[model samples]
Target: MSTDNKVPEIRSKGFSGEWAEEILGDVAEIKTGPFGSTLHAKAYVEDGHAIITTEHFKSGELPVDKKNIPQVSEDDYLRLKAYLLKVGDIVFSRVGSVDINALVTNKQEGWLFSGRVLRVRSGKIIDSEYLHHELSTSRVKKSVVSRAVGQTMPSINTEILKITPIHFPLDTTEQTTIGNYFQKIDALINQHQQKHDNLSNIKKAMLEKMFPKQGETIPEIRFKGFSGEWKNLTLGDLGSVAMNKRIFKHQTTISGEIPFFKIGTFGKQADAFISKNLFDEYKAKYPYPVAGDLLLSASGSIGRVVEYKGEEQYFQDSNIVWLKHDGKIDNAFLKVFYSMVKWSGLEGSTIQRLYNKNILDTEISTPERQEQTAIGNYFQKLDNLINQHQQQITKLNNIKQACLSKMFV
Candidate 1:
């Protein structure tokens, strides 16, 4: 990332020399979209030619589905033929996010772009895919931002884009290799993203159907070999609310032996810390949460839950609290139930805080321990898959960014 030269610091094996550079105007044809008056919103129809707005430009391939896209008549499509998008065209945002652009594929051919878009058609000397990747580099992005005008809303024009500088390998084979490499990475990222989204949707549907609705004794859906009605109980019947002993502001430090989590940092990284001695002393004297205990955020964002996991950490008292429960109810089952639990007195409250009384009085329905374990284990596995895919997506994105930084001049 620190390197800045005509050729990439990291590249495919063999055949390398300093890359060639030229203004975009010298290697491509730059054109702006049709004026707003030329294509009015009223001219749009239900089924016809699709238009490409800034909204349709995405990090992945353009969606082929025409469900929600606005369209125009055949006559209008021909009238704006100059603005028609072709395969391999690169479309850039003319205003905000002027640095982001989408490369046209076969899916987007024959579409018209809005006035807020700028199109770059590669000439015979340049490869469009290579140009797209080069434009995505941090160095070129910074250049575009530096030349952008307007304080409140940065904007770019055809003249500005035409003069933008880009560097690429002299060999077309090298350009294709780099472009295909990034394309495969993008495909993997998109695949994981799709799975993550699908699993999330399935989880949401299962949560609603697996749990009983109001005034019902049995859930709409349940595992076989479990027939009896579930028991109706209040949270107070299971446990009492407990919290850590109060730690004053002076007890905390920016960096120390153990992390101290406030309501804001309940499920995230801690910005404050306390000495190990203080943490140990406070934990011993207070009603501390055991491993697998569910910690709830009572203020700010009400009812947010996290498992303690037995980490060496302290949380803000009162604002964050947990239930000190007997061994009857399973923590795994309770964790999933928390997603569906509605705290009493939350409705029609002006302050929007979850008081201890509301949690104690909240109603719940539960089956026997064996059934509880079965249901909890099933959902937990699903959760594991979802988290694994999320982590993969994040890691792949990081790798892509690093490559983009070093693979280009």
Candidate 2:
């Protein structure tokens, strides 16, 4: 669309605020980041100052405990003082993963700017917080990114940013009002996120207490005490543990009668994949998983177990293992147990990878059937509550995104 035609005409409909267009006049100065190579942690060594980067800019706030934030010496600070970010200045990412902008709040007071970010300073024409929102809006991000030029790593230089059009209310009071309005919403979102994190930590602690360590068993419940000790069993002793047989490459078809699962699908709580209608008949000859069977990843993210609750599904040749436990083992208990073990000592190509032999040889202290049921039920209830809170967080975030899209342009 042409720039003149695509410009968002100021709407006087429901808003009491006055809309105005400022030609991004010369009142504001744009500063590109320096070419300093100071590592993030080095930026804050002895009596060091905080540094802001694309990673530090979170939902409207800069996190203080950032891992890679660079520190600067007094001499370096003096040399770069002109480019140092001040409170209310807006810092944005110009290189990779562009469009992350955050207003420098009091939390970042005295922090130095990093080479990977650009700083925008306006002399009273715009509220930094408001401008931060404007710059980060999806409309502006899309328009500005389209103007970026690069083949390997894209970048928006300072000269390009100087001409980036910004819309604002003509009155400063209106600008502050709108900025504060969104700030409150952002704060609420942060609060909810922190609560979610706390609940997750609590769940982790509970899991440690509920499960027995190696060579340990649950003490007899005073109410329903049992005389027998819990058994130490290897996974191989529990059931038929086998990796899926690979289908011949030539025989494989895109759409088949059976749904093939990759490690990604298993990571999600899904159990089945429908054939895409392109698979050859011979490729569907492997053993299919039935409902209630426990599916585990043997390689690449080993020991992630999910109970198959779907109608039917076929496993892929990826690092996944299927365990069809006999009636003696409760799948629910194993699922929770696998998650609690922390999967330590299991090595893979990446941090999430796991090996089948290591997991199979790892011993688990299995309680009697009755005790297993109690432990599973307790953790399940807690997990269900966490899921509900997570759903709420998702809904709130979606609402925020929608509001931002409509309110901006």
Candidate 3:
């Protein structure tokens, strides 16, 4: 992060060009929007000439949606023409601990900016995209924020942003290359994120349509060939609920033969461990989750469910509850059902929690065994797709972060 003359640790192939360290004001024109008093809340409309505020560009780029933005009158827009955004203007949040930014494109041109944002316009000497990314870097932010803090808000002002150091490549070609590279990376990330969100929303909608609502005997929608009313019963009727073996904090280890899980590790890796001897002793007396058993987090993050894969792991008793379902209920069907389950009639005392009795008393609707299996399998495949999309997004973000760190000074 130091502003040193040494070259970046990583760079694109065929490029080892030296970077130029220059104060931001020297390379770009800086200005802010009209003040708050000039654009009062009373003038805002639900739909009109859109105004971009600090909230609009929280992620360092302009969001596409304009109709959601608060709007001003025609007179107000003309009066604030000086503050209107033009294509290629990089916008920064003038207030906040985080340095949020955005690049104005043709789609954003002519939109009025709120008083809390600063507009930075780079000349031909600097690449607009590259400068936007540079301003977004954590290193420069750490250095500049020291001089920009305000009394009431964690903020940066025009004076400090003007002189903020911009570490940039001397080669405009390299700058463009880096800029375009990140643009593509961002596009891919957005693409995968959209797919993930769509899948999640689809599953949610399907759950509502496929499951019977309160006081109803049958769901409004069902798979083809599925007919007749679903049978209703309390959760206790479908499965024998059980709790995990009690393992006190001091009794656990940082590492051992059996992986030990607390609430935090319900669907993740075990954080602690128990010895094989201790695990076996409890296995004979206490119940442990096996294949097909559904584990539910019963603590602060209540009702988070995970089906056991029969892994060699121990679960904490106080924070976790397990469901040992009989052959009457399909494990996969129950897994999908839990995600849509809304536990009712529980009193909100301290923290919201689901007790063993609460779980037993909750109502459930079930179809025939074969129909349950088919629905469960369909949902399982959908879930796998969601996971794969999520993993791709994570992997892409990691790559992007590494590139940002290594490609910049």
Model 2 segments beyond 4 Å from truth? 1-19, 22-27, 33-47, 58-61, 65-68, 72-84, 205-231, 242-292, 298-304, 310-321, 340-359
Model 2 TM-score is 0.73
Q: Per-candidate TM vs. native? A: 0.89, 0.73, 0.93
Write one digit per residue (lDDT tens) for candidate 3, span 41-91: 788876678888888877666767686788988888888888888788988
Sort all candidates by TM-score, best to worst. Answer: 3, 1, 2
lDDT by residue for model 1 (1-409), tens:
2244567778899858888889999999999988788998899999999887767765535656556887889999999998998999999989888888888888888888888889999998778887888888888889999999999989999999988988888898998889899889888998998999899998899988888888988888899998888999988899999999888999999999999999988899999999999998888888899998999988868889999999889999988988888666888899888876767676335547787888888888999999898888988988999999999999999998899988987
Provide backbone clash counts, one per model: 0, 14, 1
Mark the 10 consecutive residues where model 2 has the least summed lDDT: 1-10
Give the C-alpha miss distance for residue 187 in model 3, angstroms: 1.1
Per-residue alpha-carbon lDDT of candidate 2 for residues 1-409, written as tens digits (9 for 90 to 100): 1235333333334454334555443546788776655444445565555566666774546775535666667777777777776888888777766666777777777777777788888768788767777777787777678877787877877877777777776566656766786788777777777777888898787776666555577642312554466788877677666556664545444655566676776645444444444333323655556667677876666667777776444566646776656666776777787786655566545646556556666677778888777777777777777787778778777876776665655
Give model 1's TM-score versus the native structure: 0.89
Could you arrange the candidates by lDDT from highest to lowest?
A: 1, 3, 2
